[model samples]
Target chain A: MNKRDIALIIIILIIAVLSYCIMNISSDKDGDMVLVTVDGKSYGTYKLHEDREFEIQNEYGYNIISIHDGEVCIKDADCPDKYCVKQGKISKNNESIICLPHKLVIETVRTMDDGGAGDIDSVAK
Target chain B: MSKHVAKLGIFIALAMIFSYIEVLIPFSFGIPGVKLGIANIVVVTGLYILKPQEVFVISVLRILLMGFLFGNMLTLVYSLAGGILSFVVMLVFKKITLFSIIGVSAAGGVFHNFGQILMAAFILHNEKIMYYFPVLLVAGVITGILIGFLSDNIIKALKHYN
Candidate 1:
């Protein structure tokens, strides 16, 4: 490997490390909401603090979601690989449990303490 | 020249075969959109061997044909985004002539992941999709290096044979 090759490798490594740090820091549990999307459509947004169990059904399959104690996870899924269920619990914004087979994505989103702030933050820039 | 067209066709076919091999192997790493991107070897090799326009044509045709044969509309979008972006980056690096084929290919791999994730974020309408960026970057580097080495060997073999 030449100097350019080594430099490129180093740059990529630095980017990887920086990105990992960014993802971890950004996922901090500042958000109290979870957004469920099915096939690119918004299903609903639920509170993370509230305890509840709900099932999302679509033509592909279904994913059962559970929320309790400020965390969310896939309680169960009919998809061939239970990867979503295995994704475990997520309590932070940007953390998502995705069921690729079902095209279902449950992502943690942060809403401001004032309900209206979420919209402004998300939409109004 | 007819020889040029024939060479491009062969490269496209090889790329398609590589994609099929990946599918047959079931190399799912559990994170959606993560794959070996092994077909990239063909693109890198083509970059080094063919004219710019010829390489572009081969890359676009490969994605379109592969999408039609083995994927759906969504797959078309993902592959187009990734393939085009990676091809562009590879071309730019090739022009700069600052790195080896392996370095250029590695950069192409990372850019490919970025483009795919960007399209996914848009389709899913979720900003949180950015979370996958880091993991994808890491995966990109690993796969890029693997494919780069493979492409380098293939290119060298072809040169020796020629």
Candidate 2:
């Protein structure tokens, strides 16, 4: 490892720390937990009544997301590209399900006063 | 009409096939953009089998086609950057490390993702984009290792078979 290599290493370390912090911070919860479901299977859970909850699913190599409730996950997906999954929960606020390879995403968001899913609505349009 | 031309054609086809096959399998990596990068194996193989110019051709075609078939056209720029960067890095690393095909392929894979992320950060111009670099790097490392390991065995098997 030369000086260049060393510099690259430091940069990567910083990125890892930053990525961890961002994911953790956004994954935070400050209200009642929401039971996010898809096709009746419990993929994951988040705390935020209707308006503030988010959930994702990795079903058979395809990722799906549920914004406020279980009503929506990625409409279409395959392993080819999960751009939609990466898109995350893009609400008008900043949430959406992205399927990267598939190039599909639901960039729709909802407002939250309590940051809970209790007020979340479903518009899988 | 020409032996070299036939070989180059064969390599291109093989790379495309590998890329398609890799696209089908689902990776367990929770993070997005993680995969075997199997098509990269062909790119590495081309470097070994053909001249540098031919290798470059294969690399560009592989990435461009993969994007066109599986990705949005808007992503073409990122794909081009990644493929070119990896090709260049592999060319340089070849002189320094002189490792086997697998080693070279590994290096190429890491370079590929690093280049892509770099382009993404540039286009987005959001410092926040920097946060994803580390995770992408780590994933790139693991994928590179896998691609390298597989290609190594392939060379070994082919050498003996021939």
Best-fitting candidate, measured by TM-score? 1
* lDDT of candidate 2 at residue B150, scale 0 to 100: 74
Q: Identify the runs in model 2 with alpha carbons over 4 angstroms from their true place.
A: A1-82, A85-125, B98-102
> Model 1, which residues run further than 4 Å from truth?
A38-42, A58-61, A68-70, A75-86, A99-104, A109-125, B28-30
Scored by TM against the true chain B, the candidates give 0.95, 0.87
Q: Against the hidden true structure, what lDDT does model 2 obtain?
A: 0.59
Task: Provide the TM-score for each candidate, comma-separated.
Answer: 0.84, 0.61
List iRMS (one decimal) for every candidate: 2.2, 8.7
- Summarize candidate 1's per-residue lDDT along B107-134 as a digit string, tens digits: 9989999998888777766666677788
Per-model DockQ: 0.50, 0.13
Tell me the whole-model lDDT of each prediction, alpha carbons only. 0.82, 0.59
Chain A TM-score, each candidate: 0.81, 0.36
**How displaced is residue B92 in candidate 1, in Å?**
0.7
